[model samples]
Target: MSKRARLLAALVVVMTVFVGAPADADRGISVPAFYTPPSSLPSENGALIRSEPLPLALSLPGLDGPLPGRATRIMYKSTDNNGRPVAVTGAYLEPTAAWKGPGKRPLVVLAPGTMGQGDHCSTSLALQRGLILGIGVTQSTVSIGYEVLAAYRLLAKGIAVVQTDYVGLGTTDRLHTYVDRVDEGHAVLDAARAARALTGTTSDVGLYGYSQGGGATSSAAELQASYAPDVPLKATYSGAPPADLLDTTTAIDGTELVGAIGWAVNGFVQSDPSLKPLLDKYLSDAGRAALKDLSTMCVGDAIFAYANKKTSSWTTTGQSIADVLRSEPVARAYIDGQRIGTTKPAGIVRVATGVNDNLVPHPQARTMAANWCGLGGDVVYVPVDNVKTPSPLLNHFGPLLSDQGTAVDWLAARLAGTPATSNCGALPGQ
Candidate 1:
């Protein structure tokens, strides 16, 4: 067996123990509804695990569609962001017209924001994957749950949706790199590819994500041109994207969300070997335990517990995770590498940010836009402002849910071959 396979098997065993279910009884790990795939997949050691594609007859009546009709589900497998083989069991909502209309259909790659995965957590993979079905969390009434309403938006529009369970969260592996670009990007793009294989649809592709999803979309977009040139990417809609990891780290350091960020960084280090040793010394027993516990935590649980609090003072006195990271050249190099868009962009890109976002600050988005422009990337930067709340400040996690119409419209224009203005106003090094 490959190293990845061994790792996957190990994770599955660990998850089974934590969830208190027999291996055979656990069919698959459930992900957020929006990010959930249609198929039920068994856990595997490889990054991309395979399962029977979800049956296409599930009915959803709440959300309107880009197209009108029944949606279908399928199971697929692909490499995680780190090239580990894994399974991505998700559904594809397709408008009834999509079948007869044309040989091609535009694709919407939906990357879900945070959802918890602790053993006791409601959004745990055990819950997301159907091991525990009949969940009361309805599609429209999602609080900290994985909502599948957004998938319908693309399906109704005659576009196929591709969603993945990422690596460890769904099936029990190591970590979910909340916003780490590479691994998240791979899962996002791989889902798109998986969708294409199932439908054999050949049309322009568009990317859409919010919060951590934004970071995944950004990673996929930046890498699309080089990684999947044949994808014919049309546009990317990233809401509150964590574009600059380093900048975001600095912005959220020592705050409540610091632990959540640290959890993600732990995943990043494992996926990115270069960052491991740099941060190894600072990971106290408590910190490591927290990371392990958080591996299965959904986004809501992870962030709610640590949003405004400072980092735990349990580590060696006077030492912080940041301090340790800063002292390591390998960690610094890896962090700096993600500051700009390194991979070639496949099509038009839209980057949205909430100016007052305490989670991922507007400045980080601005800096990312600037860096993209400096690298000659095609990008559109949008800053959301609400008249009542704050003119220039958009809620960190609210824009995608509230103003998806705007984002969808922008993607529609791009699909129609319209040009998008790049935010090159402040280029890097200016």
Candidate 2:
């Protein structure tokens, strides 16, 4: 067994002792009506479709009530990559702590790091229950309690948070557009707009995310100017954004999260069906089955199913997923279109990455920061200098745990109207 699989085994043992059924356990165990989209959506982007008070399980005792805040599960209208209106699901938290900052409360849209492609794996569900178990015969799920800490930290600082489920993670209308830049960006921006519509107040907005969420926020930062100019961005913190698809796929292959390559293929084809035939031509029978299997899997299931595997095993040509992309111009063009740093992002931004993040590759992330810097954009590029770990996940997750507190503080400072700093002068050395 791989070190990654062994670590997952250890986690399962630890989590099994603490895991309990959630209060509002997704009706996926039965039937989920809340996840079902309506026949028609609100015409305007960011328009609120529906909402209900959502109870949170991780609240703390306070003089008034809970230390963090109240939450609402919301469905809101947003445009997909196809230019059609889609109803995206997410959670909106009204912070209980007093905002000592300079504005009338700020909203930070927390794009969750890769939560699964399944409806039950939504991060909103994690916020409600503090843990999630993906019940399947072959699929075991990791507890998502860790990721919720970032949201709680923001809420404690009197910062409102909106955790987007992206295009389809929770909503059952379509397959989750995993890593699709436009869909993820629209989901992030519209989430902020939806929160303001719910509160009926003007609030400064920020974007915070890591891993897949990092890619989403970075894309959102770039897309905000032309896509949703009405939604002003105060700050953006994108940790380990997967800017280059070929590099990212190459890094993940033969690792714990090898199944992620399947996710990228599934998502890219969904966004532009024009590539479907080409994908069909290249995938082996094993590849087809893997895609079908991974479409419904969480991190644990994926790790268990495809750890230490390679995309070459899934292809008819035996070419790795990266080579497959290089083999076709249409496919290569699609991948290039997903690349970040093409245009200047709208707001003050901070891009941080683990120097040894084998999962997302550190160079592509640093390249994004440098690209923004060359555009004369205000950017803070942080290299989470950590020693290399043999475990890919540790190499990736360590920096997230260590640097997130500082990243959150930096964003909070931006919201408080602090004069932003740029390391562009020193970027050339990197």
Candidate 3:
């Protein structure tokens, strides 16, 4: 086999060994009982409903090591896009090691990137189980991806990390809201509040994420001022944020990550009930089957299942989802509402993107940075110019490894209360 083919085979094998079976499997795949919330949720947002200590052995899965702190699984109250009460699940890690830094120990709200649309794909579960692979045979495999490692790095710094599963992914039976800005932002901020209640520390907070989590962190930065003003957000590090869904969806379609389009559509149906009928009207039988299959998948499975699958194949009119978005008023409206950077993040914000990232076009990221800077937001825009591989997928994944340490250091400085210098004034192509 060719080098690329060998690499792909190795990845598939590794993922298969680690992930083992679909999340719906009768054994091996464990979904916590807390995943089932009470019939009626509490009215208060960020209220801690329950908590359980997770031993360190299970806490640092895939890290090949132990964490610096104790981990707690928490089911907390949060609001959905419509501000309705909902239950969210996440893991809060409090370092056993003491913070040697100045002021109170810092808390970092770590928003994870796209895992999948299934509840079993929860980041909290992945952290505890040490597997980042998703459900199904085609996507089965073990891979330790960025989010957990980043959380581990932050924990090593004596900073508490609260990794949210976002709304619906961990607790609710409903579909995860995916990239819906309001739900994602609310979930991130509220996770912070819930973390404070669990840890009883009012430490300065920082937000960090990439890809889908990046969008959440960026949205949290914008919503923190109005939604949860009391939660002092010190800084935000958003890597390859999908600031414009309209542009991003178009770019992602027909790519290896086309499954994400199905995820997004599932989210839209969940968030806006009216969209379901519209989808039913426009989607072909194949499209309906694809969505159902996609719903069970994590990111890895989705990528394998829908790799380079044309969106046009799923639609009744043979139009790509991106084209349908432009033509369909309801879909367009819902997608438009997910666009980020409308409000300035109330603190220093660092936005980074891989120049060669084919999944999330770098130009859109630049536009987002420029928009924030124009609105007087302190922005540090870093474009990852190094391309480790010729493949678009590798270009997107390479920067996560290359820049992880730098991203951590940036967050550390912000948590240390050091003033951040802006590169907005020197942003290229501005």
Q: Is candidate 1 or candidate 2 better by lDDT?
A: 2
Model 2 spans with C-alpha error above 4 angstroms: 1-31, 134-145
**What tens digits encode model 1's per-residue C-alpha lDDT throughout 69-151?**
44334445555655656554444545543423334667777777765433223222322332232222211011233334455
Q: How accurate is candidate 3 locally (lDDT)?
A: 0.80
Q: List RMSD in Å for every model shown.
A: 10.0, 5.5, 5.5
Clashing residue pair totals per candidate (backbone < 3 A): 41, 0, 7
Model 2 lDDT per residue over 1-430, tens place: 7332343243334332124333333322321478889999999999999999887766655665565778999999999988999999999999777889986999999998987676667877766765565454433455464566688778767899999999988888778889898999999999999998999997889999999989999999999989999897989999999998889988999998888888888888888999999878999999999888888676666887789998998899899989989879999999988898888988888999999899899999999999998888889888889789898878988888899889989999999999788888898786
* After superposition, candidate 3 runs with Cα above 4 Å error: 1-28, 56-66, 132-146, 388-390, 428-430
In model 1, the runs with Cα more than 4 Å from the true position are 1-77, 80-86, 97-103, 116-147, 254-256, 273-280, 312-314, 386-394, 418-430
TM-scores, all candidates, are 0.73, 0.92, 0.90
- Window of ten residues with lowest summed lDDT in model 3: 56-65
The model with the greatest TM-score is 2
Q: Is candidate 1 or candidate 2 better by TM-score?
A: 2
Superposed by TM-score, candidate 1 places the C-alpha of residue 203 at a distance from the truth, in angstroms, of 1.8
> Is candidate 2 or 3 superior in lDDT?
2
Q: What is the per-residue lDDT of model 3 for residues 295-340, given as tens digits with 9 covering 90 to 100?
A: 7677776776678879899999999889988888888888888888
**Worst ten-residue run, lDDT, model 1?**
134-143
Backbone clashes in model 1: 41
